[model samples]
Target: MISLEHANRIVGATLEKGKALGLKPLTVAVLDAGGDLVAFARSDHSSAMRPQIAMGKAGGALALGVSSRTVGDMAADRPSFIASLGPISRHGVIPAAGGVLITDGNGTLLGAVGVTGDTSDNDESCALAGIESAGLKAKN
Candidate 1:
């Protein structure tokens, strides 16, 4: 099983990389297949809201079974469905930066990763690195 510690290790490693690269402090989250937080971390300087934002993004990815980037594109093309999802998600409706789908080697939905602090692109890259380092898959 991809335990919470495994996920946190990935998030921590990615954060270390981000710090080395001069990125801002961030909040990172990893969810289980049930869209529940299995791991979560916030940089020393990260804002209090960062964790919630990360969780929201991760939740969205898990619920849709797609990357948050795809969710953004879908929301752009289908506003109705996207809008409806806002209320439906309740806790998983971020549709923002730094969210990704996590999968097993066989492409099973394992969970998701979400990051916040830098630009969405940077967040995405960090999250991708974290997931990949954990021997999981993410839509790069």
Candidate 2:
């Protein structure tokens, strides 16, 4: 099962790290094995777009059973597939940055985390912190 406590802690950590970096307020999300949101948070001044962006990343990870970044890179070579993903399982097709696969040492799927409102690299760093906090690793 997904860990709600871990989810909350991760989002909180990501937000704190983002704020420390002076990045814009963001939306963060934790999704379960099914890609359903386990936890979600939005920082002050964050726009409505943030949540969906984070959700898209989480959804993409759960649906593809792979890191969203990989999906994005593959889409670069096949834009049509990415386009087609829009109509398919709405939650299953996310392409934005900040989505990452969460896995344990055994490589078992734990779920995913998604962050938005910052550059891809910054979002990634925040995610890295949270994943590490949970003693799990982000699958790129």
What's the lDDT for residue 38 in model 2?
92
Model 1 CA deviation exceeding 4 Å by range: none
- Clashing residue pairs for model 1: none
Q: Write the per-residue lDDT of candidate 2 for residues 8-72, one digit (tens) a residue.
A: 88888888888889998878899887777899998888877778788888888778877777778
If scored against the real structure, what TM-score would every candidate get? 0.90, 0.92
TM-score of candidate 1 against the unseen true structure: 0.90
Q: What lDDT would candidate 1 get against the real structure?
A: 0.80
For residues 19-124, could you state the per-residue lDDT of candidate 1 as single tens digits?
Answer: 8779999788888878777878888978778887898888888778777778888888987887788677845577765899877888777778888889888888
